[model samples]
Target: MSARDSATVRIDASDTLRFNALMPGELQERARMRARPDFPWVARQAAITLSEAYRGNLLLTRLLNDRGRVALALLMLDMHFEQPDAPGLTTGRLKAEAVALDICSPGRVGAILAAFRLFGLVAPAPDLDGRRRRLVVTERLLAIHRERWRTILQSLALVLPEEGERGLHHIEDPAFLAAFVHALLEPMRAGWRPAFDVPAIAHFADRDGGMLIAFALFGTGPTGQPLSISQLARSFRISRSHVVGIVQNAAEAGLVRRVDEQGSRGPGVLPQPALTEALEAFVALVLVRQAVAVRRGLAAIGVA
Candidate 1:
C-alpha cells in the first residue's frame, strides 16, 4: 500500500479498535461527504468558526493559537480525562507524552503549562507524592474545550444532523466529554496530521494564527480578496510583521499570491485555488472525523 493508504489505515484505526475493518467504509464516507454540493460551504464555515474563535482573545490566542500548541493543549486535557489520578497527569508525564507523540518540545510544553496555570486553565491537583506535581483540568479549561467541541459539532450538524445533535445533547456530560476528547486525541497520538492530503497547508498550519489569517483573508468564499495588515494583525493578536511573514511564506509556496505592491501596509493577498481546495478538503476530513468521534463518544456513554 502507498504511504497515503497507510496513513489512512492508521487514522481510522485510532477511532476504534473493534472497527478496524471499517477503514474502507470510512474513506468512502469521507469522499461522499466531500462530494456533497454543500461540503465546501460547510468546510469554509467550519474553518472560519475555528479560526475566528481565537480572535480577540489574548490568553487563548497565546496558549492554543497554533496547530502545535492546540495539539499540546488537547493532549493535556486528554491525558487528564484518560487518567486523572496522580502520576497520570503531571508536568513531567505531559511533557514526556508530548515529546513521544511529536506534538512539541518539552520546553514548549512546560512553558505552555505554566501559562495555563497562570491563566487559571489548570491547577495543581492534590497528591500524596511531593516529588512530582500533579495537574488537573480546571473548569475554565474544560469550558474552553467545550466551546471548541461545540463549534465542531455545530459544523457537523450541517452535514450529519443526527450524530451532531446527539453530540450537542450530551456535550456537558462528563462521560461523553471524556470519550469525545479521547476519540479526537487518538488520531493525533497516532501521528495523524489533518493536512495529510493537502501538504501545502503545512505552511499555514504551522505558524501562529496562520490558518486563522487564511480564513480572515479568504472570507467565506474562495475570492481571497485583499485585507489590511493592521486589521489581520489586530484580529489574531499578532504583529504586522508576523502576519506579513505568514503571507510571504504562503505566497512562496504558491498557496497564495499578492496582487498589489502595497507590501505590509495592505496588499491584495489572494488565496490561490490550490490553497482554497486544500482548506476545503481539510475541513471536510475534520467533519468526518468528528462525526465518527461523536458516535464513539455516544456509544461509550451508552447514549445510542
Candidate 2:
C-alpha cells in the first residue's frame, strides 16, 4: 500500500485509539505525514540514510539490531541518566525491565549484556551497595547511541527540516540527548513499535538481523538487482540458513518473492509491492515519531 493508498485504506479504529493513547494524535499525524505528496521521495531518502548508517557499524549494529537488543540498550542508557551517581544498570534490574517490556527474557538480557561487555560497549562500575554487579554505559556505547540518533535525526530532517536539524545540532548536548532518550523510550515502554502500523514487517523488525534484510530489500528499486541469501548472510554475519529461513518466512507472508522460481535464473529475492509500501510507510511513521521526540528534547532545553 502506497501512501496514497493508505489514505483510502480503512484503519481499525481500535488500533488508532490504542496508539493515540501513547502519543496523542500520533496515528492521525502519521496518516497525514504519509498522505503527503512528497512522502515517497522522503521515505526513499530516509531509507538510504538508515541503510548507510546501519552498514557503517557492522559489528555493534549487529549486536544491537533487533527489537530486544535495541530496547535493552536504550533502557540501559535511560537508567544510567536517571541515576548517574548510583548503580542503575545492574543485571537484575535490566532483566526485570526487559521482562516488564515483554521484549526479551531475563536470560536473554544476561547474554546481551555479556556481549556488550565483550565488545567493550559496557564496563563494570563500582557497586555502591556492595552487592549486585553494576555496569556502566561506556563511551563506546555512547558513541554508538549518538551515531544511531544522528542517523535517525538525519532521516527525520529530510521530512521535517527545522525539527530534524535542530535535533542533529543539539544531539551532542547531554541535556538534549537525555531528554530525547526519555521521550523515545516512554512510548516504547508503553509498547509502541516503530513498525506497529505495518503488520507485514512486524516479524522482521522483531527478529535479529531481520530489519536489515527488510531495509536492504526496500533499497533495491524496481530496476535494481535483488539480494541473494548468501549476500544477506555475509553482510549481516548471520548463518546462511538463517537468511534462508527469514526470506522463506517473508515469502510466505507475501513480503518478498523469489526472483527466479526455477533454479536456472539464480538465487535472489525481490521486494514485492507489499514490502515496498510497508517499508515506505514504516519510514514515514518512524520519522513522525522521531519528530515528536525531537520536539520533546528541544523543548526540554528551552528551544522552540
Candidate 3:
C-alpha cells in the first residue's frame, strides 16, 4: 500500500472522543495544567472510564436493533450518578423511564437488571430496598471498558482511515469508539491467541474491508463462487490493482489458490477449501462479536 493508503488506515486518540478543536494556546495551557502537582488522578481516571464506556456502547449498538440501542443508551444515561437529581431516581423509576423512551419491553427489564448485577457492571443502591434501589456503576466495569477500548482502537487504527480522508468512518464519537476498542481487546486480556487475526484482516482491508469482504464472498461469481480477476473487480466495484492485491494477500496467507488457467480469461477458480474454512471461521467470529456486543448493550440498559 502507498503511504497515503497506510495513513488512511491510521487511528488516533482524537478518534476516541468528540471535542471541539483546541486552539494552540489552549492546548498548551491544558498540557501545563495536567502537569500540576495537585491534579486529581481520579478525575483523569473517570474521564478515561467514561470515554471507554461510550465507545463500548457504540460498538454494542451496531450489533443490536434500534430498540436495543436506545434502551442501552437510556439505561446508561439514567444510571449516571453524577447528575444532581440522580439520587432520587429509583431503579423502578429508571426502568419506567427507559420504557417511556421506548427502549425495551417491561417484561424484559428484570432480565436486564439481573444480567447487569451478575456482571457487576451495576449494583443496587442501599436505600430503596435492594430490589428497587438506584443503579450504581462499578469501577471494575469501567476498567474493563477502558482496556477493551484500548484494544479495539489500536486494532482499528491499523485498518480504519485517518481524519478528513477518503474512507469509511467506522466510529464518530470518541467515547463510542473507545468502547468498541475495549470490546475488541477483551480476548487479549487473557493472553494472545490465533483468533486475533481479525486485526490482520482489518489491516488488509483498511477503509474498504467490509465492502471488499462482501464483494469477495457474495458478489464475485455468478453462482456465488470465486471469480477471475476481471470479474472480481467488476463485481466488487474496485480497480483491478486492488483485486489483484487482495487476491495475492489471500494466496500468501494460504486462504486461496489458482485452480485452473486454461480459459482465455486466464484463470477460473474458487476459494481453496482452506480459504472456505477460514472464511467460515471468520464469519462465525464476527457473529460472536456481534452477539457479545448486543449482550453488553442490553446489560448496560439493566436487560439480559
Tell me the TM-score of each prediction against the true structure.
Answer: 0.88, 0.89, 0.35
lDDT of 1 at 291: 86
Question: Which should have the higher lDDT, number 2 or number 3?
Answer: 2
TM-score preference between candidates 1 and 3, better one: 1
Query: How does candidate 2 score on lDDT?
Result: 0.78
Model 1 C-alpha lDDT per residue in residues 43-88, reported as the tens digit of each score: 8888778778878988667677777888887777776776445355
What does the lDDT read for residue 76 in candidate 3?
Answer: 52
lDDT of each: 0.76, 0.78, 0.41
Give residue 258's lDDT in candidate 2 (0 to 100): 80
Q: Which candidate leads the pack in lDDT?
A: 2
Model 2, span 1-304: residue lDDT tens: 2222222334366756776876888767778888889887778776666666676466555798876788889899887777557558788999988898776898889888888899898898877578778888898889988987788888777668888899899988888877888887887786655555677766476666888888888877665677778777777777878778788888877889887553553588888888889988888777887888889889989997
Better of 2 and 3 by TM-score: 2
Candidate 3 to truth, TM = 0.35
Full candidate order by TM-score, most accurate first: 2, 1, 3
